[model samples]
Target: MAFTNNFSTSFHWWDRIFGTDTKYREYRARVKAAKKAMSKEQQLEFERKLMAQVEAEGIVAEAEAEKMSLLGGNKKSKV
Candidate 1:
């Protein structure tokens, strides 16, 4: 029973590592195939959408940081 438990645990560890690598490769391949399948106009549209998403995330992050700084500075002043 102990040996079986140890074997199962080790198997899961290796499986997780290899499984993630396989999944990443599959994701990259799918993305490459989809990009190849797109026309120039479609590709440009996709890039524009991606950049918009990235910019939105950055703005959100900056706003969060500014809010946290304001809250932190206010607390220090009250103390």
Candidate 2:
């Protein structure tokens, strides 16, 4: 959720057929709002907890955690 994008790659079919994507999208919005309400330390703690939850659920790959910007774009290098 902190990664700022909504997707389930490793188990995409599970996410689509079972409909977890909708719930995950909603949860992401909540995550952003929650972080906005917390101090820096609290936000870090919250993200840690959130990361654990998502990792356990297998919603995305470990690579998603390292991304600070949205995936797939052409801001500086447009083709």
Candidate 3:
């Protein structure tokens, strides 16, 4: 997955990755609302943490893909 600075576009990448972009957006809306009371700095920090999490998940996904390929025919398609 590509790392994007824009949250909307970033979620687009995630939607492709998880096949549930819409659901993720709904969840994000709830989370965003909960954090709406925070300062701009806090929001930025939250976004940064979320991006880091997405990055880690991407790495784990890539590693899993590699491992699965090693097993030959029983391949599961990656997002």
Candidate 4:
């Protein structure tokens, strides 16, 4: 359906398995387009809901620290 780059030369798995293949690229593009369409506000709302659930379980602090570390921030000092 959607054509972008040279699917034949871009992908190399086709020659190894069977022949030329472009189906994977189409599937990937569709998934990426869907993700790009999601609004930032929707993402934030989902995060808020998730954080509230974690807070209710008394693990919000731990979860937040983990998230910060993943984003290259320093974890809490043991001292």
| Highest-scoring model, TM-score | 3
| Runs in model 3 lying further than 4 Å from the true structure | 1-27, 70-79
Task: Please identify model 2 stretches exceeding 4 Å from their true place.
Answer: 1-20, 59-79
**How well is each residue in 1-79 modelled by candidate 1, as lDDT tens digits?**
1111122454666645556334334444755776898998987787677556656655665566666685642335555
Predicted candidate 4 versus true structure: per-residue lDDT over 1-79, tens digit per residue: 2222223554566533663344444445655565576787865665566445544544544455566774544655565
Clashes of each: 0, 0, 0, 0
What is candidate 1's CA lDDT for residue 14?
64
Strongest candidate by lDDT: 2
| TM-scores of the models, in the order given | 0.46, 0.44, 0.50, 0.27
* Cα displacement (Å) at residue 12, model 3: 6.9
Model 2 whole-model lDDT (C-alpha atoms): 0.63
Question: Rank by TM-score, descending?
Answer: 3, 1, 2, 4
Model 1 residue 23 CA deviation (Å) reads 18
lDDT against the true structure, per candidate, is 0.54, 0.63, 0.62, 0.50
Candidate number that wins on lDDT, 2 or 3: 2
Report the alpha-carbon TM-score of model 1 versus the true structure.
0.46
Total colliding residue pairs, candidate 4: 0
RMSD of 2: 11.6
> Tens-digit lDDT track for model 2 on 1-79?
4222335577767776766577576667978999889999998899788778766655454444534335533334346
